[model samples]
Target: MEKHGLRERKKQRTRHALIEAAVRLFEDQGYDQVTVAEIADAAEVSPRTFFLHFPAKEDVLLADADLRVDLALRAIAERDPAEPLAGVLVRAMDQMIAHAWDSDLPTGLAALRARLAASVPALQARLLQRYLTAQADLAQALLRAFPGRLDAITASALVGAMVGAVGAAALTALRRGDGPDEVRDAMRQATALVARSVT
Candidate 1:
């Protein structure tokens, strides 16, 4: 068990190093100008190791972008069966907000990823793909968590409403150059609005 834990930690460190290196390189030279080999070298890892963690260069950005999506999905999947849909969604949104500012807030990895995705057409496409997948996953999870209480259409709509509201608020805050607190407040406010509309 200890050996497995250690191996997992080492893998996580390598992954983190690659992401940090990629972010710095992208910032200094712009995303289009940076190469996978450069990111691997900066992370002090072999190019093969980089591929082991991320399938392609574009996958790196997607990994960061999907972090919050993964968090929310996990939260929804693990929610208590008896919990209301609104309550489960609000809890998930709160987790996502916490993750948004986990590093540095105003100029953090999350912010940088969002900015890059906005300006880069390739990243924008990839983000849209993953976001749609996340929305479907969330809807499916809600259906399972709530069982007969939610139909497929209702589940989809509920997930869409929550995602749309929170995503719009977060995007607005990012564009406004809001700090971490402001971003959190915006998302929380969005969550509250959704909750009120539903219940």
Candidate 2:
């Protein structure tokens, strides 16, 4: 058990080092020019270690994605049994958005991600891929959470609409260079709108 804890701590430290290195390199040299090898060297880790932490380079810029998925899934699974599907989804999104906000300044990772998404084709492509995967994953989780009540089609549509609404609003705010508070407000309004329609 002590060994497991040490291993996890080591992994977290390595991941943090890689993220710090990648962000600094990307800032200094731009995203497209900073290769995985360079990031690994900067982090004092092997290229293989980089892969173990992240599937691809773009993921470094969007590191919060896994946390977002896990948060949404946990919220769904742990919701009250009597809660409606829409309520569960809205709650999940609320928590996810709140997590993202975190009292960040205007020049935080959210803004950096937005800037990169607008400039870098690879980041944009990765964003699309991540969105699709997240939707599918969230839908599956929802199906499991409300087995008899929701068919695949309904589950897909509900998840799609909720995710789509939140994405659209947040992306719009990001593109407009909105600060954390503004982005949070936009996301809250978006989720509330979806809840109204779904319920």
Candidate 1 lDDT over residue span 47-153, tens digit each: 99999999878788655547777888789889976787789989988887787667536445656767887788887887788789989988998888888788999
Runs of candidate 1 exceeding 4 Å displacement:
64-67, 103-107
lDDT (CA) per prediction = 0.83, 0.86
lDDT of 2 by residue, 19-132 (tens): 889878888899989999999999999999999999999988777677878898899989998998779988999878877886222437676777788889989999899888
Error of 1 at 3 (Å): 2.3
Q: Which 10-residue window in model 1 sums to the lowest lDDT?
A: 103-112
> What TM-score quantifies how close candidate 1 is to the native fold?
0.88
Clash pairs, model 2 backbone: none
User: Largest TM-score belongs to which candidate?
Assistant: 1
TM-score of each candidate structure, all chains considered together: 0.88, 0.86
For candidate 1, list the clashing residue pairs, or say none: none
Question: How well does candidate 2 match the true structure in TM-score terms?
Answer: 0.86
